[model samples]
Target chain A: MAQYELYRRSSLGMALTDTLDELITESHIDPQIAMKVLAQFDLTIAEALHNRVKAKAAIKGHLHVYRFCDDVWTFIVDRPTFKLEGSETVHADRIKVVACTARAPPGGKPE
Target chain B: MSNQLVPSVYTYVIDEVCEKVAPTFAEMGVGQNVLAELRQTWKRKIASMRVADFDFKESFDDGYGVYDGAGGQYGTEYYGGDHNDSSFAAAANLAALASGVGGDGTAPDSYHIPQNDGAGDEAQAETSKVVETAQPSQREIDELVQRLWQERHRAEGEAAEEQGRGSLAKQRIRQLDGVDDDDDEEDEDDNEDGIGSDLDDEDSEDETADVSHIILCQYEKVNRVKNKWKCTLKDGIITVNGRDYVFNKAQGDFEW
Candidate 1:
């Protein structure tokens, strides 16, 4: 998890690695929570992408924020994941940037 | 009393839900195919939206099945109100064609079912499908690309040997294998049918220039297009519009 960075310049030129660094280190977002969220993402759409009974959106988002091409996709997990050091539990919101190499279907929303 | 939630019960309830919802929904002019396609599309959409561990263990038109393990089972075929059994992507591809959204013009025919001609029976085949959902890693992509490249060269070499030399087979092998691009350049000039002219290098280009022109650039991680023409993890290569392009499992990018 530590070895995997959220890809440099992810989400249309957004500095994802640098931003993740700030969110985790400077902004004090828990590392465990953040990575877990990303891992979930990797497991879901990122994973199972290469093959399917159907052609899946390699990148699919329900909550489309049409603002920044740099807008980070984020959502909180429902169940408790990791226990914080002080008996507090953490459920990090999974996050990713839309930088799909696949072109969206015509009239389809931009990544 | 707790054990009352039998796997069959779960299966029955979902079957009942579809049996009820589909017909009523069809009354509004939504055909069974569109309804089911939309159903699966939304199912996937909702699944993608979730940030937690969630599984509906859905009762699809073919049957109901549990995930991470196999327990519950049901078939909508037996309890049908409206049954249009095409996968969402396939059905939607058809719909897109009808609506002028663009598609391959394929009529919806083949749906995903286990091929029984394999060395396994139905259960074994279904298990294989369950296994395929795992995400492909970079290692897998690399191996596939390398293997495809090797396979192409090997097949070409075999054809070259079997078909004998001095014919167009040898020329194609030379082109695909990058052995001797300039060997037949003078002769190919006179043989101006453009039969094997794609091998000719117009200008001094890098190593990749010899190989088929990259039609599409596939990646391990899906993302929007980028600037660098650096090496990409191409899944497979195909000829489109007389030039070669690489493609991947991602559908609808086919510009043929």
Candidate 2:
């Protein structure tokens, strides 16, 4: 449980890291040794996208709003604990990385 | 002639086919075969609807389950009826089918329930009198989207682990393990009915929960014309009709 705390984090960075952790937990799962049968599945592909609109910023020059859905492999998550989903974008200047998180559904976290 | 027996007979034939074929495919472990058989069963029922002068789309509603309205438009929510019997039925059926209890078009000796005499007529009358409404609450939709999103992560993480990416494998392992923890937390949060109280309880724990989570996006095919929405989730994103929707489980946040 302690090892998986990174995945259950609220931060985007930690969420991404947690995705990897989840993968490890699912692999080579033995039912007799554990509580239940393991649900063996894989995550092969993922698409991360960001679009941003900023209202107020310190240095306002021609801020480039680029559709960044294209770049493949060039972009990487700094943190693995965080898990990313859905369609979203971020607005910033001089930013090294932009990570997107989904809007939590109208209800709360799932039961 | 005001004959209701024709449609009922056709439904019985179709049900017979489904009752025979669905289990066989399950035992053979061929999902496509099962789907094809189910689709045929649906087609047969559709014919029954046509013969009875009822709208096929209206009565059958979606392929997954029957909706609660006319024109199959409103009240188009999930299957919210009796789960106890179906759960047992589905499980028993699956086990029997998986064990090769019967062959194609052969009714399992053990699987026979009484037929409904007036059920079809009542269903027909009910369909004519009601208009469809959105039965699922906003919360139900959200939960559906969330569950789908979680599935996406499980899928992608497994793929990464297979490729021997040590880090990716480790991450997936952690998430899989976390499911148990979350389940415990969820149980604590769940109401007696077990709807989605775990989500409601997350607000207080949001800060402590890690925020930097990885999102998995999954792509699945959905056919609106067929009243089918197939989806797979990965990296927190759900793809249906080639469009993307996100599922963020983090607390006090909704955009991903």
Candidate 3:
């Protein structure tokens, strides 16, 4: 199961991701909690490059996912290239390969 | 939003998105360069104009979303005022009561809730923002890590905290749940084997484990000094430096 967080975003589609040196994505599902809650959902992560089937165009290094809906995009990825500042990597942030996951309610199953 | 061009990093927009390529860029994780490739600075000036008419409700699944007495998919966030007043735990508890996922938030006959916490399908799903990210480590890897880490701790004589070594919630997840059939039996076996740390009532604290929140319980570290080398006895086979050594736990020593 993916973790959930209250994220502040711009209407144009950007989280105040680096506000006060915090990545908004980190606030989503906790990496450990994700294991049990997200076991059922089918998931995939394709690199943006060399894959034409992921989206309408090309994106480099972006993860390719086959979600039932378009709404579930903002993933809880471990700060890949977006290097963190001091004390950021001190705790859980040091963990590698954190997966993003979220389970939807019954009513909103994608069409 | 476009004209703002507030320099920093970690920003995303759909207008700049090229479906196929964008998803790949998204995989690398967000950065200024990724955004540079995705969004042209020349067109960024229109961001403010583009967002002028942007509506929160427009992002919702439908005009008004419905809850199945379980989780509610309200679409992208619609945060207003100070949302910090409500915690995920509180929201989960409230949602459980409202949706009746588990009538009293108790462990029902099914393995609905991962741990004994009142959190079940509804609390675990609805309030949770179901973002579609890549799969992290596989279950096999998780188990192996758990096993190897435990073995390493034991070999190092750092097994005092036997109950709280790894993610206990993970060990409880039922691969094929629904009825309390074979999983229950396996759960019991796990409890006895000492592998399933949470099965024991003594390790209940592990249930309260919340790796989700930023305000975590930073346990005091015990920097102890000891010999780095150890004699490991595994499946009666102990590989040393490069040679196989015969380990005798009773004798508390090893022979080459």
lDDT of the candidates, in the order given? 0.30, 0.30, 0.25
Error of 2 at B83 (Å): 4.9
For each candidate, what TM-score against the reference? 0.21, 0.18, 0.18
List where candidate 1 sits over 4 angstroms from the true fold. A1-96, A99-111, B1-29, B32-37, B44-50, B53-155, B161-256
RMSD in angstroms, candidate 2? 24.6
lDDT per residue for candidate 2 within B88-137, as digits (tens), equals 34434443443343233333222211111224433443433222311334
What's the CA RMSD for each of the models? Answer: 22.4, 24.6, 24.0
Cα lDDT tens digits, model 1, B1-256, are 1111222222232234334555444554445643343234333322232312224434332322331123111123312312232222333343334323212233222212222123343456365553462233445434533544454455555555665655676566667666455655656685564433432332222123213211122333322333212122222222211221112332212100
Docking class of 1: incorrect
Residue B255's lDDT within candidate 3 is: 13
Regions of model 2 farther than 4 Å from truth: A1-41, A44-111, B1-31, B35-78, B81-204, B207-256
Which wins on DockQ, candidate 1 or candidate 3? 1
Backbone clashes in candidate 1 total 9
Best by TM-score: 1
Ranking by lDDT: 1, 2, 3
Q: Of the pair 1 and 2, which is ahead by DockQ? A: 1
lDDT of 2 by residue, A1-111 (tens): 001111122122222223223322444212221111010111011111111111111111121111133221111122112122222232222211122322231222311
